[model samples]
Target: MSAATTTEQTLARYYHLHARLYDATRWSFLFGRSDLQARIAALRSPQRILEIGCGTGRNLARLAHCFPAAQLIGLDLSADMLARARTHLRQHRSRVILRQQIYSQPLAPAPGFDLIVLSYCLSMINPGWEQVIRSARQDLMADGLMAVVDFHDTRWPAFRRWMAVNHVRMEGQLLPELQTHFQPLDSAVRRAYGGAWRYLRFIGTPRPIVHR
Candidate 1:
């Protein structure tokens, strides 16, 4: 199998057991989720929003409250994760659409989403993170926004390696990639747990596609 496929399988297997405990366990570490939602709500009232790797639909459900009139799509690769998401987001089912898939390419009839979100999942994507970012750009409308909140990097080697064991790579690479594909509207990296690690929040809109 290809490396991307391998990465997908790895994440699937990892979340299989973690999905049940995800919502309860993640609160301590998965910071900035509510803040990111608030930031996005304050900036735009997008008509359509797409969230990549919307694990357990935690953000999606909250987003439903944030933007009551917006259509929401929550895409995740793990069936187990999507299962939890379905149950967690059932109340908003009328407006929330959940899909089980990897975001390797633009969705059909591309450039349709007014807001795209990557929350605390991109860092775990291993070999496919950059491709996912590019694909998200294609799926974004010309005036649409892309919002991300994820691990930036850890200062301690041991902590970094520990996160890697959980399929996360926190080397501060995502921000630069986001800046390259979009025009940054708001971005910041802040320390966490007394400098043990840092996380970032990036909000941007797609840049004009240049042809060589």
Candidate 2:
């Protein structure tokens, strides 16, 4: 299947059907979201924020708490997910915009967004996940920050091996794809504050090529 088609199918199968159960299961498999949140709180430029693959708006809700003054945009490919997000966000409807669309490309160029966050959303993409990260790097403003927290294979042999096999059997997923996707991006892997989960956070700002 083409990238677009696969994107559509993945959204429907995983996000649409799974969105209602997302936050319930989130703390189980998605362990490092708070690490992403801390990085988000530190951003100073482009005060507006965008969250790509914002499943069920859980992160958006927390982000609103952290940055109440920032305008929020949440986009997801799953209509069902958006439905739940919409309902949850009604109280803050004026402060939020939810779009049912894929983030395979850069969003309509907006000015001065302080931050764009992707929280545990990269593992599901079959391909072009790297491209999405790259596109986000380009779309950022000079001082804009991009914060991402996703699955990572810690350099431990036994636990790494166990998580790899366990995830596929349990959730039909694995982190190697995302590990490979982010390998070339300017980023680092830090141990999460909680006990077991390690976080992969990358920050990018537009760097102009200097003429010698």
Candidate 3:
């Protein structure tokens, strides 16, 4: 199996064991989720929103509240996570759609979405994260927005190693790649836990495709 495949399986297992604890435990450290949503809402009134790796539907629930008329899709690879998301987002069933799948390519046959979100998911994707970013560009409308809130990097080597064991890469890598494929409208990195680590929140529009 490829490295990406192994990583995907590993993450599925990890979330399977942790899905129930995710929402409760993650809030303490998974900073900037609400802030990211606010930043995106400030910039656009998206009618169709797609959130990749929407664990436990926390952000999906927020998106539903933020955009009352928006049709929302929350995609995750973990069945356990989706199960929790389904229940958590039950109230918004009319507007929210949940799917279980790895996102390495564009959604077929459907028109692009007005907004795409990745909340704390890109870092766990290991070898395929860059491809996911590129695929998101394809999944977006010409003037669509992409919003992300994720771990940026850490100052402590020990903390980095611990996060690696948990399948997260915190090396300040995502922003540069995001900038390459999208035009930044708003982006910032904030310190967490007194600067032991940092996380980023970004809102951007897809860069115009360049014809060769």
Score candidate 2 by lDDT: 0.66
lDDT score, residue 142, model 2?
56
TM-score list, all predictions: 0.98, 0.75, 0.97
lDDT of each: 0.91, 0.66, 0.93
Q: How big is the positional error of residue 161 in model 1, measured in Å on the Cα after superposition?
A: 0.7
How much is the lDDT of residue 126 in candidate 2?
48
lDDT by residue for model 3 over 140-166, one digit each (tens)? 998899999999999999999999999
Candidates 2 and 3: which is better by lDDT? 3
Off by over 4 Å in 1: none
Best by TM-score: 1
Model 2 lDDT, residue 48, Cα: 80
- Candidate with maximal lDDT: 3
* Inter-residue clash pairs, candidate 1: none
lDDT of model 2 at residue 9?
Answer: 81
Mark the 10 consecutive residues where model 3 has the least summed lDDT: 103-112
Q: Candidate 2, 127: how far from true, in Å?
A: 0.9
